[model samples]
Target chain A: MNPAPSSSATDAAPVLQAAGLRKSFLSGEGSIEVLRGVDLSVMAGESVSVRGESGCGKSTLLNLLSGLDTPDAGTLTWAGHPPRGDRRAAFLGMVFQSFYLIPELNALDNVLMAARMLKPPGAAERARAADLLARVGLAPRATHLSTQLSGGERQRVAVARALMNSPQLLLADEPTGNLDERTGDAVIELLLELCRETRTALVLVTHNAVHAGKTSRHLSLHNGVFQ
Target chain B: MPWYLYLALKQLFPAGRKFPFFTAISVLGVALGVMVLVVSTSVMGGFGREIRRWTVDTTGDVQVRADGGINRPADFLAQLTKVPGVVAATPFAEGVVMLEHNLKPSYPAVRGIDVERVEAVTPLSKYIYFGKLDDLDDDSVILSSQLAAAIGARVGDKVEVYSPLLIEALKSDEAYLGRELRVCGIFEIGHQALDSSLVFVTLRTMQDLYGRRGSADGFDVKITPGLDPDEAAARINAALPPALHGHARSWMEINHDLIFILQLEQNMIFFLLTFIIIVAAFSVTSSLLISVVRKTREIGLLGALGGQPRQVAACFCFQGLVIGMAGTVTGLALGATVLTFRDNIVAAFTRLTQSEAAIERFYQFKQLPAHYSASYITAIIVCTITVCTLAGLLPAWRAARLKPVEALRSE
Candidate 1:
């Protein structure tokens, strides 16, 4: 009983923890509640999948946890830093549904752009960006504009750009939704390989029960809470 | 990399298929704005100075006189020299006179000057086309080429001088008795103000009309270089004896109307030509807006990477600034080229005309004046930059305040 009193006694490493979280979206009529006093714990170096129906607010919960959006009432912290420009960008990396690569920049330039954001005056930042681009197997296309890359390559660049600052948390919102199953598996494997090597906490928001089996922690979002 | 300006610009103008069009418009706006400003500015600058010189060379900087009389004392000329900015005080007499040739007479303004003192004040002696400055001492007169040709008189040809100054005879006062005099000199200034209406003679000639008194109506004084005419006049005015009220004025004041017109033209040209710059700025803004709209995904990505709202705004603003700067540089180059060859260009246009003489008379300038002052150049540059930065505001704000979620959602 005395040892169970400490919060660290739980299996979770407390990469991110929320207590009695609440969120409501204002519709034309009034407000539609999205989450109702939910509590959850996610550990460091654990990959979790959230599955729910279309209107069950799985993305909303992931956004809240990643600090992309704020909950109406909740206390959440990640890597000991709250959501802010530098730390948030450094702590969490999100793969949006529609690969948001800067179109004007080349693949390496895109990755370099995010790296530049991390430490502006850092010397040899370009070489580091080049290394990151090469690691993503885009060495030849480093100077090719994002528009030149195929959907898969574009997504790969987006993934590489996410890791530009070496993020501590990785969030994938239907990372495979836009690709064929074969290509999707390749991306999923890439995400898994990168996250495992970096020891990053991972969260996947998806409706595919198949993806749920790929993670150690799986939960169903129902009503306004997760169980 | 992280500065709001660099990031925003980097995001807004990604290399794409549309890059060529954007760059071209930027160059065009700059070149057009520069060309128009250069031509207009240089022309107006020349017009004003020619008018100024036309007046400066005619009348000495300051004209001093006894307030209530037609003549000043003999010692006045010597006393006038002590005044500051009085390089030389030369005595002169002027009166209306008639010149008769072949029984046909024409009237003109006549001035008599000392042969030596006038040398320092005017270049009349150097320009005598048909006669010499030394001949001013002869009983022979110097008739302007225009008046001489009209009267059918030439150097060594005799003409009668009928003075307006009257002599009192036993019965009543009468105009001076006519003198049959030889024409000794003829000068051609081509300045209509000088050529058509003026006649010069030796100071002794004007004295003879006044019964050989050898006195003058007033003295014309010249100022040293770098001296402000108005200030010199003020100093001379204070230096004068109370008996003589000196009228002091600048060369600009004497030709106020012509000067005013030149200034007005300069202003109108400046204002009208600035629209070119404005149009360029508009093009810059438009191009950047297109870039921002096209790069919506890129903007969204930057936002996702922890780009602050300010960074988005800065990027858009920076793109606009870049366009503006490009236009400014292009304009400067364009303006400089036009200004550099302004003369040859105008001469070419004038060559297409039927008569070079007619162009000369109409424009009153031998070569187009493209006088450039540092202030003028600075003004054009500042104005261009202002409009350029202002043009960027709307797109920059749009970029800055973009909602990351919404922007990412844009296709």
Candidate 2:
């Protein structure tokens, strides 16, 4: 794996910071810990990857970071303040392994979902959604439903949706886990190029070592702690 | 254009022809419930109105009676006719009397009315099926067809009538003073109670028999067209002489029990039919619960994208509202159509079943009746929507309470 980029003087302050994070799950008769005393910080425009074996809590850590799940004992702050209420969606975006696109909506509508969470989409938002679909090379398929799209196209549409609101931090959990090698590589390349163009920070969780090598920083999880 | 509304519409009528079957059934259930309620209430209201109209037409809209009797009916009739809505007023006397025909005795209610003014006060003249109302005289009586049948008397037959006063006189003197009257006509008003109990004669005959000269029991008043009987009665009461201790009452007051029973029956039917809608509303709850389960992951995705729990709940509620609206509109249309063609439908059914006597024996009417009111329709719509919305609450609460983590973790 490529080594993380050297610390630079011009880098901005961290957009996401989590410290002493701990999480547990109840399995049958006993409680099992998923994350333990984990600390992480991601700067603006920085790309980071977390790699681990299955059930090693990489997805758990990503969920906690994305605010989709809360830690048992930890403080997570977005831009130095606790992400309370709907402020998290304003600042952060997430991509899942399953794409999680609403089946009822078309690809363009799925892309517009983030922007429309708090309010109705205007003409400008609609135009931007169309542009994002074009950028993802699926403009012709914008009107197609999730069931009609191929796996790679669905993931690409999901990527476009995650960027709809131009969030400062993007957390992706095994986004390419359901794709073939060629389609996975292509999706990853497209995602990285868009993140770089927008100067958005990325925290990706993956099992692919080759994919992890493409990020600026690489980390591994063992025993519920990142090293 | 709210996001939740958009989500609700998308979920309810999903693309690719994936219509929610359970939701459609729920809507249909509400529609049928509303349709039945409307049709039932309308028919009941029509029946009540018809009965009231018949009562007023037969007995006059308002009746003015004195404490003992109107000792001088001319002044009373003149004053009553001068009232604002009084169209016509006539003096009438009534009593229970025993009539003997061929030595078979039958008690019937005897009424005395002025031959000329009776036509103006009541529609009795129009219901005359034999002879003429003008033929009534001191010695001639108009017998209701039912009373005539019971006494085995016919037109031109001599019937012996004994008044209560005559019976009292016979008890003291051991001699009966009775009137041998001829049946001048037979009338049938299509009301069993009135037809079986009423006999009409001239005002002089009742006065002479009861020993009340130059007086009558009361005055029957017909109000102006379209005037409410209660209002006319009120006006008459306000104008009455308190010394006479006279009272005026509308036909409705005379038959309050029957009217009350009709209204109560209608309300009971409405209440009972509403339960059908409530049961239908439960279907909405069940369908929404299923939707919540099927869309758990999508719900989590929405939450992660910043949809609040309240918004999630509102989404399901909106879906319920849509279903209610659809059902209510369709049901109103269906109900109106059914009511409009009620007579035809009933006739068709009767013909198909070949049960002609069933309709006549049960309803006593050739055609079914229905009355539609705007207020009633509005109430039904409001009631149905409220029920549907209430039914949506439980599932909506369950959906809102779902944890994003647990939901996303589900397949």
Candidate 3:
């Protein structure tokens, strides 16, 4: 059974809901069923960590929940309704294993990119981006290019970008995968702290049990189902 | 600014960095192409303009000729003066003559002009180098500079002229000899062919030599300023009496073949030079294609962050537009700078090669000229920007086709 929710997790509406989600990939002639009939739900201000072995469909599940890929079989909703194009930027944020920061933009600009997706950034948005960078401990490196930053600093900048729009939910797909053990611990702590303080729900997908244990609830993916 | 435009600029210039090498290389390629186009088109236009000016200066704006010859010169002159748009008119006759000076024989075209009226129709006095146009009398002739140099003749020297009329006189068993006239002046019209083999004499003297009295071959007419020569010629032709059997031709019509050739050369150069911009645009396409491939994951991040496919495409499209604008502006500036010093550059080049005289002989121009047509420049700007903007479409399509999940999963 999953652990009890943190105090920040309310008995209110769930930020994300997915039922009977399924995905398949073509491998040669026949197909490989990557994901089959998964169900997941996370409440506002709650942090849920999903741990799995290699190729356990954890990333595919995240992709489905984030609506980046179409699930062949089931229904999904964001805050009780269908996902919308216009609201996507304001409704959700995503972090990746690769950091995926645009090389041309500096840390501040990279963080501001998320806000820019919603609208052209004004002074308020700029201040918020700087504040988020400071929250993630990247205030000093705000002007540094992605190439100029260390791996941990880049990941922190990505975290700041993910929260720039103040989305209701944040999906992090092994964001600390490329960093060292010490840096990875720090990134996980920062993610959990920010999510709780902002009252934003978090779905953390990772292979590290220590990182997974830090969240309010933890589930392990075995085969294509949660165990 | 929109995020896509902002990103596009950052990609090209990239904050906190020196000029990007890729951007610089692409911009320079387009700049060189545009510079060549501007310089070449301007020079070609200059050649055409200079030719037209010289032609209208040597001959009048319009030339009136008869089916046989104008039988009543004085009557025709009075009638021409009454014609609307006719500023002035002068009578003339021309034929080839064998000229001998210092025992050297040369065949040259000779024109007989009305000394009093020629100045009103054509500015022949401005071309006189050694003597005055008023010095030209029935007993005197003005030799073209090159012809005078070829036969070692100078002002006040006497030269013998043998016209075809002398042969006809001999056939009739009439005692007629070649007319001898003093060279009263030397004129250079700055045209190779005109300055090389042309002579001028008074009309009465020419009539005495050719045995054609009280007649002229044609009359050269100058029209009111700013009036179209072709329109003036048409008016003159319509006003002439059918009994005269005369027609008027504009200077443009007289040199139609030469003007056509010049226009053809200019168009061909423009057509050929356009390929350089196409080549540069292709390079831009290539670079953007590579950028799309390299930034696949970042594109996925953009999509995941709620950037629509069209917005993603705009990012790449805007890059091409920025490059084109920057290149065109730089190219025009560079072209203008180079044209300003074109004469100096040509002088240096000719001096180094020791071909100053040969260049003058071959090009028939001592100084290079340039003319910038507004229409031509506008076409270049529009065409170049369009080609460059279109260049981005393929890469943008490729970028937009990427599925966010698949792109993010790309290793």
Candidate 4:
């Protein structure tokens, strides 16, 4: 079940929520129904995992939650209100299975890119980005090109990039999928560590159940519903 | 602002990335268009300046004559001078008589002028290339260089000058009727049409030969620039008594054919070569469109990443402008260089053809002495930049209306 904030916790709403989220894809053959009805919630400083098999709607759910794609039939909300469109995606940080780091940019540049894309929060954005990169233990390697980094190194940078703007919620889909077992564990630890530091809510998708156990809660996506 | 154009330009220089061949071709097309603009426009501009010089300096800005041939009015000169903006009015006593040297046959043209007044109006005085304007003594006449050479006359040589401005010569004698004229000077004037055609002498000489006294056969007027030739002519016409009408001619009314042909040629060249610029702009269009297609995912990412569609549009539009501006600037440079060396270019072509006969047959002028006018250059540059901006449209449109998820997902 989705968790709610404790009374002792500050009177803050869940950082992210999705109610009756449904998405479907259409082809010439007919249509494919991926997410029939899904609901999700994560409070601040909480980490939740969605462990699922392939062809499920885990990624599509993330797409809708992040406002990168529209939902076919449900409401998606961030903070308290429904995210109207792409601009709301700013409050949510998204990382993917492939890292999807722009290859031409250096690690630091990629991280700073997101912060810069946000309408100016004033002059301190650059300082904040550098400080954030340092917290992720990527400060020394900040200027390194994406191609020069190992697979595990790239994911750290991507994670650091996602956390650049001190986002309210961070969603990662198999961020460590391409990494070795050791690298995957290290990247997960770094993600959880950063989440605690920022008091940000986290939702991670993974195939590794053992990894899911490390989160505060975990769920299985079975038959278009989360359990 | 989208951060995408910066990304695109950065990617352009990425390691292992080969140059986009289309960019090179676009630059070349721009250069070619600019080259055509410089060369053809310069030639046309040169021709216009020459025409203005031909009209203003050679034929006089305005020419006035009387309606009837035989009636020479005594008060006409004073009346013309009284007209506002009449800079100077001069009388000419002209009629037909046979001109000949010891060798060739005699020919006749409208003949005499007040030497000083003629100089004030016509470029003939300035055209005395080898001799002096002061050389037209009372007994002396000036023949054009071509005519002088044809008759073999030089300073101190005597030849017969004859005017056939009237039909009296035909009426009087079937035999050669003429008087002596000492050749005082010869002129080339660079006006080939007039060189072999006109002969000039004092008005007193024409009055004696044409049997006209008091007022000469007709008079010519030089008008001030501020004066409308027609308006001045109207004033002179109104001032005159009903017996005579002041018929003053503006330049186009006189050399209508030459000017009409030149203007038509200049306009034809301009309209024809405008297509070249249009094609160049089309190159910008295609280049920008291709750039948009190549960077579709980038645009989508920018849109997804918080860029307004307007910023995305600016990115592609900036790319188009960059390509266009860079190309136009480079083209202007290359065009100017080509114009600077156009003569060598033509000479090289002549040498490549290897035919003295063909060289003699083809070129209008030996070297293309381009009249460098700033207005023409400005026009070419402005028009090309405008065309380049228009060429940016399709790509900018695509950039503005892009859907993020669909674009990135397709990639």
- Top-scoring candidate (DockQ): 3
Supply the DockQ value of model 1: 0.45
Docking class of 3: medium
Task: Please give the lDDT score at residue A191 for candidate 1.
Answer: 78
Off by over 4 Å in 2: A1-6, B16-20, B67-71, B82-87, B93-215, B223-235, B238-245, B349-366, B373-375
Predicted candidate 1 versus true structure: per-residue lDDT over B1-411, tens digit per residue:
454655555544546565656666775786688668866876788677666665566567766655453355456766768777789767777777787889979887888888888777655665689989787763778887777777888888888887755434423753346867788888766565466667887787877754547677677668898898788878877877776655655666667788788888888888988898888888878877787788777676677777777767776677666666776778778877887887777678778865676876677555666677566677787887778878888888877776765676677
Q: Provide the lowest-lDDT 10-residue window in model 1 chain B.
A: B166-175
| DockQ, all models | 0.45, 0.56, 0.76, 0.37
lDDT of 4: 0.72
Give the better candidate number (3 or 4) by TM-score: 3
DockQ category of candidate 2: medium
Total backbone collisions, model 3: 0
In candidate 4, what are the lDDT values of residues B326-376, reduced to their tens digit?
677887788778888877887788788875335533432334546766876
Give the Å error, residue A135, model 2: 1.7
Interface RMSD of 3: 1.1
Candidate that beats the other on lDDT, 2 or 3, i.e. the better one: 3
- Which candidate leads in TM-score? 3
TM-score of chain A of 4: 0.90
lDDT of 3 at B292: 92
lDDT for B374 in candidate 3 is 90
lDDT scores in order: 0.73, 0.86, 0.89, 0.72
